[model samples]
Target: MSTKYQLFIEECQELLAELESALLELEIEPGNIDGVHRVFRSLHTIKGSAAMLGLEDVRELTNDLESLFDRVRSREIACNPKLVTLSFRYKDMLTEYLQDPEKGLPQDKTTQILMDLEQVLDAPVHAASRPVESACEDCGSCRPENDKDADILLRLYHLRYHPANKSFDSLDPMDFLSQMQQLGPCEIHASPELVPPLDSLEPSRCVTSWDVILQTGADEETIRDVFLFLDDPGDVSQFREINVDEAAKLRQAQAAQLSGLLAATNRPVAPLPADEDDDLELPEPTESSSAPSSSQPGSPAAVSSIRAPSSPAPPQAASQEASEAEPRKAPPAGGVKAEEIASIRVSATKLDDMVDLVGQLVIVQARLKQIESELHNPLLTSVSEEIERLSGDLRERTLSLRMLPIGSTFNRFRRLVRDLSSELNKEIELKTNGAETELDKTVIEKLSDPLVHILRNSIDHGVESAEIRRAQGKPAKGTITLSAMQSAGQVRIVIKDDGGGIDPDKIFAKAVERGLARADSRPPDRDVLQLIFAPGFSTAEKVTAVSGRGVGMDVVKRSLESLKGTVEIDSRPGQGTTINIGLPLTLAIIEGLLVTLGEEYYVIPLSDVLECVEIQRGDDEPERIAKAYDVRGELLPCLVLRNWYHMGSTGPEIEQVVVVQAGNRRVGLVVDSIVGQLQTVIKGLGRVFNGMRGLSGATIMGNGALALILDVASLVTELEQREVAGTGRNKRSDRSH
Candidate 1:
């Protein structure tokens, strides 16, 4: 119902995930004190939060778990496999409790686990068997057994209500007072002697502190039940029983103190304005120091009040005020709350909007600089240069705001690895490195699905069985290592596994069966390995829910391509497999090289461009060209950009070529000119241009011109496809068949 409650629910779910992970780890290492403490803290926090929300069953369930961990902490009991299993069951119970708080706690499974827990808890304790009379004598406070209920006390209760958040938007203090009135005779008072002038008052703020004396037959517990949702136990609020006579005297003292406090601070005013109502009253100083003249001083007509439940004794804070009116005591140890962490929760949409706005500013800055250089005025140029520097700095800082460590994404896989390995009957270990490396939040969110596919493939297909690994002179447990590092302006993630690797023959056969590979073709080993990424192709003997779907590896390739990234895999028949993926740091903006092909502009990401060099080609016709170029002494494969785009034009005698590397291959891109580098804001080419390849996105330049951004990774893949198409199965048919 309240935003704070909603926030609590969201956070609770996240904490539960971490809690489950910790318990599973603890199950493996029973002596881990840190793990036990982590579980205890999570459960304790959940219990207190549930108590404040008045979710009784959820609170009780968490309390039980916290108590179990407390025993583990005290060395009274060790963490066992059975207890960890029960803890997981309890975790699920908490989830169902959140969904259906009204339904009674499900008793069937909980009862058995609880009973087993009791037996386990009692196993180590050897209490002496003693007679009933002796047991009674050991505890004098314990009364003799009686069926009749103990007499209810008429003692007074002192209650102080403090809300978790003091803002009026979160809670109402008067509504709490009304609930107290429903219990018994209650009189509440507030201290408002220094009320700011009416015009200066903030209507949304809460300034009044409550002091109340509730005269009721209800014991302290019943009285406390009224403020259950208002405060956590022993905090922000205090409820304790006091002597009835003392409560009466205290209320009288509070009234006297309030009157005295008001008379001391009140000052008489002259008159009211014409628009002011004549009946509106203001406090006037009274002659007597102990009592007020007619009306209570701070009791304004607009304040929320309850009718006196009985002989009106001023509320608890009044009594406290009376005591304070005498002397102040030293503060208690926990009188102040710990300072809140310095962070803000912002939605992803907000960050995207900020980047978009910053991108616009950058484009305008470039436009201004272009105009200034054309005019060649000293003063105008100076201003433009300053604007350019500031905009660049602002762009960097804005993009950094979207950068988050990749560790959170990596940590989520730990649980997946633990669960899936158990289900598949495999002994596997996952190790991660460079988790602290940072990337754009949007890019990281898109990475989860692809990483899952890659990791699952490594587990289900690449990893060999324990028996097979041991027989092959490998360790019984297979290891999957996921490491990431920053390279140039990209983040490179490599997932390597120590398991049985891909077999080229099987991959080629599977591709041929799926009509992807020619029946008689005999490609190189490396080329055959690439067939795993082809759509509708798998080497599985049978289909299952997880792997034989045949669509996973293709999905990984497509998702990575959408982010302007590249994925390459290497495998040996028995040495295991490794997959390397490279992605741009951020998709919001990139430093790009602007080039022209047939008067149409294009942007190639500057990160991928190694250098620009002039190329010498003898022929002008596209059909007469060779696919390789000699740069200095090294020969590199070339992609003729002008011919590829069907511009129907020839390049000059000496053309500029941008040498870019994709994976292990280098390709020369021929363009008319290299137009330096600047930051480009990437905009998507919508569904109408979806079929286009090698072009990832579009951007606007300073001269009101549009440039299509080139995707080097996909371009190289396209080149590979063309090469394969040209050398058809017919060329190699004799070698295989």
Candidate 2:
């Protein structure tokens, strides 16, 4: 595909996302004029862009939707649930078609949406459903003098259109003019002044300008919508509403000009008075015009725009009238200027390549530093240090390019929650917080599935139904808040729901029945809760479409572990449940604590390390490899790396215990020595070693030696399990005695 076509697809997909969001907002707040206008503008731009790209299917479909919202804008057709649902279906279908335009549109879905739209447009909107326009009339200062005046009033508009870029690649100005004609009786006049002589004229280039006089009841903003797809309409088009006196003057002036031109050309044709056409009054549009434009104007010779008055036109007022009308528009801080924001769309593959290149540079820099130290050459050391600084900066910058706000991922769950809530016959509101928290783009992409599973579980099991909630003295509507934040170089995401929390007894009983827990032993609540993450473990008595096959939570656990992240849950029986997840800011490079165990070296993520302390080794064999050590005053769980890896020799007289935080507990890793902290570029072990326990991945050291990166969370979990099994054995032995 051509770059232009790809870009068009990307742009339309983004617009469709915004369209869905607007439609959702409209569903909630039917009177939200801002949302209605937003829906209209998104559709308008998509349709115009599609037409320019020769995507008639998209253009036609979007145009129909745009007309529906246009009426919603005019308050002719009230924004209703039926309209919102139909718009969503259309948005979804358009999204699919854009992704694979060669397949053409799905006729069954398209026809259904169009048929539903027709039904909605033809349905009568009761007075109660329409927004109350006279609410302000009771206020003394707001009442209009003419209380019985017609709601829709005809206005005369003058418009000038000149193509900013004469190239045919951009949108055709004639297409916009045709749209203007549909509003009412419009006279179009084409000026051929810029048209060159036939001998010199380029057939592919357009130089003609158009003048249009449109008499329509549509507001100035509505007219501006015709040219909405232009990158910058103000540069090529001008709109000025003419008052009654100005219209009369313009008509007389235009008639004289036409007469003079006709006589000078020696055409011998009588010039009709402009007012003569006024006899053909343009009838007002019906309550709504939901049909797409049937055809494009073949010629621009008939176009005419109202002439400007002697005074300068108020272009700012005319362009900003729509915004001004929305009294409760979102504040500047809350609104994003998507079009104005300077940004470029880049592919994930390119970013991945850049990250890979940066990672190589870091490895090369490390090797250089190792040589510098070994040779102890002053010049070599200086050069190595400089290269190190530059490489470090480059690495940081490249990794940041992969960082994206998690909000987009968060917004996606809104649709999921909405559909599920309706399916389950519940009323649930999904709220988001700290969406601006940024993480590696790779992390965010992988993060979506886990988040979806968690959210589904929350809606299915965490949040209670409306009847259950009300009986429990809670509001009928349940709320689930998904939030994220950054702290100490780690992104923390929390999925919290205000619903009935998990029951420890039920979880433990299910675990025993599933053979995942001991039937004779009662574990702590925390351990019982951990059973939820076990493979094929579920507490649901019966399977349902949403969940209950015991698949989602385990996937969530494995996915997080693969990302070197952790998840923990906290619950209050009747209050709610909150699941907390911790993830690294970037996965490309991380600060790691390098430690040597016997002949091998390993790197521990610095983010998890709390402190390092020196401990003397004991000569007693059992004491030397004790599972617990006293750090300061507290007895922390300890793992002896040398013994765990089954190294042949243990020669160290003094060992360093690196205390690292794993989930909720702290564990000390005993190693031969501390090799200091360094930026570790993580390298994945190939498929041969995929899912290797006790190791997340590996990194390269300064000496070009491989250092396996410790999966502290996994190791800690293993240690805890061992302790639990040992305790169980001791208890059983005591009962036998």
Candidate 3:
């Protein structure tokens, strides 16, 4: 794909994520104005960008969604469950159209959504049952007249024109008037009643009005069309049709007076002056001007007598003469204002690539620091320290570029909960908090599916049925809450439900039935509940395919683990369940505790490492150091690296025990020597090692060496399993005794 197209895709994905999160929030607090505004803004932005790229279908669909939001924001419609559900469908449709504009708009689903939206919007307004009428009192016409077979005619009328100061530019009044002339003959009479003196004219301010006489055989529709494009609908006033006989009489009198005046002038005949009065006044044609011979020389006396003694030249005529003698003013300094021009669209992919390159540079800088430490040269160390500081700053800024508020992803779930709850015949309220917590763009993208699955599970299984909830003295509606916060070095996202909690016994029985555990297995309540995340583990008596197949939670767990994250489950038999997922702030660079086993080096994530201690190894050493201490009384089981990985050398005389914690368990990993702390650049293991155990992945070290990054959680789990199996065998032996 072209860079721009790629960027569009990335931006669209981000917007979609944001839209989902906002929707979820709206599900809980349907009247949340901020949530509604956020979703509206995303849709508006997407629509604008798509229109810029000529993606008409995407633009049109988003425009409709935006209009729906406008109604909600205006309080014209209450946010009902139906509206929220429709919004989710709208989001999905917009996403589909963004992906493939040629697919030609959303299918019938979009129409249905829009119909539902209209119904919601029209509900209150329709209940009032009031007839809609034109705001103008004199104009009885409800709609504009057609232009076909229209004749341009001119009749005198008192008119008032007020250009909306906020809408139309001062220099552009003539353009609008010119458009008006297209509909009919427009005779403009300048009314100087409101005109201030030239010194205080305020050229930018409108200082005059036009008493216009427009004659058109076209109906009122054509006349209104002339002003339809104007920003202020109420400005064009005193509009009505006049009789043709009256118009003809006025024209005849004007012609006769002009002829008499021309006869009186010794010089060439000047143009007839326009009236300055706000009201229309047409002089009566009398017996004195019955003949057309007033143009002759002998009629000078008659012409002079007909002219009013004290009347001065009309303002229009003087203004025209003055305009010929003066030049127009220049525009203000600084080229055209920025707001007058349109905005440009850029792809977000280019920005992402820039961030990635910056991350790599940070790693390289870390390596240089290592080299500087070994060199011990004063000058080199000084330069390295400066570079290190710069790199650190750059890394922070680069990572920030990829950080987006969790709110973006939270908006989308509103629609999901709205729709899913209705489909399942349940009432679910979704609440969200800490949506402003920022996380990596990639993390946000991967989080959507898992969040959706969790939410679906909560609605379908965790939340009690509406009937059951009501019978149990609970509110008819159930609530699902999604919250996020930054803790330690990771972003913690929790999805909690106030519904019927998971049954530990059911989970334990299901695990044994699936052969995932022994029939007689007795584990802690938490451990038994965690079994719901195991593959194909389900307690639902029947599956309807929405969420009950029991394959979703496990997938959610695995997907989170792939992002170097962990999921924790908390539940009570009669209360509710909360699933907390902890994800690293950024996946690019991480602090690691470097250690060695034989000739190979491995980096353990520092976040998980509790502490490190030196263990003296000798023939007299205990067979197991389950009681190893690290300044605390806590006993941590130690795993010898050389023995675990089968390194080809004798054990170290003094092995270092790296105490690492994953979830609630802490274990000590024994290594030959400590390699000191190093900045590790994570690299994915190839497809061959995709399913590898114990190792999370690989990272490049400062010395250009490949170091395995230990998956602390996996390793700790494996060790615990081995220990448990050994204890079980020992118990069997005791039974024999």
Task: Write the residue-wise lDDT of candidate 1 on 306-353 in tens digits.
Answer: 222233234465566456432233222212223532465777789899
| Order of models, best TM-score first | 2, 1, 3
The predicted structure with the larger TM-score, 2 or 3, is 2
Please give the CA lDDT of all the candidate structures: 0.71, 0.74, 0.66
Predictions: Cα RMSD each: 13.1, 9.3, 15.4
Task: Find the candidate with the highest lDDT and give its number.
Answer: 2
Better-scoring candidate (TM-score), 1 or 3: 1
Error of 3 at 648 (Å): 4.4
Stretches of model 2 off by over 4 angstroms after superposition: 128-341, 377-380, 622-626, 727-737
In terms of TM-score, how similar is model 1 to the real structure? Answer: 0.72
TM-score of each: 0.72, 0.78, 0.65
Q: Write the per-residue lDDT of candidate 3 for residues 572-666, one digit (tens) a residue.
A: 86688989888888777778898888888899988888778887775643334223444367666766656556444677778788988776677
Per-residue lDDT for 161-185 in model 2, tens only?
7773377765567666767776777
> Which segments of model 1 are wrong by more than 4 Å?
55-57, 89-341, 620-626, 727-737
Ranking by lDDT: 2, 1, 3
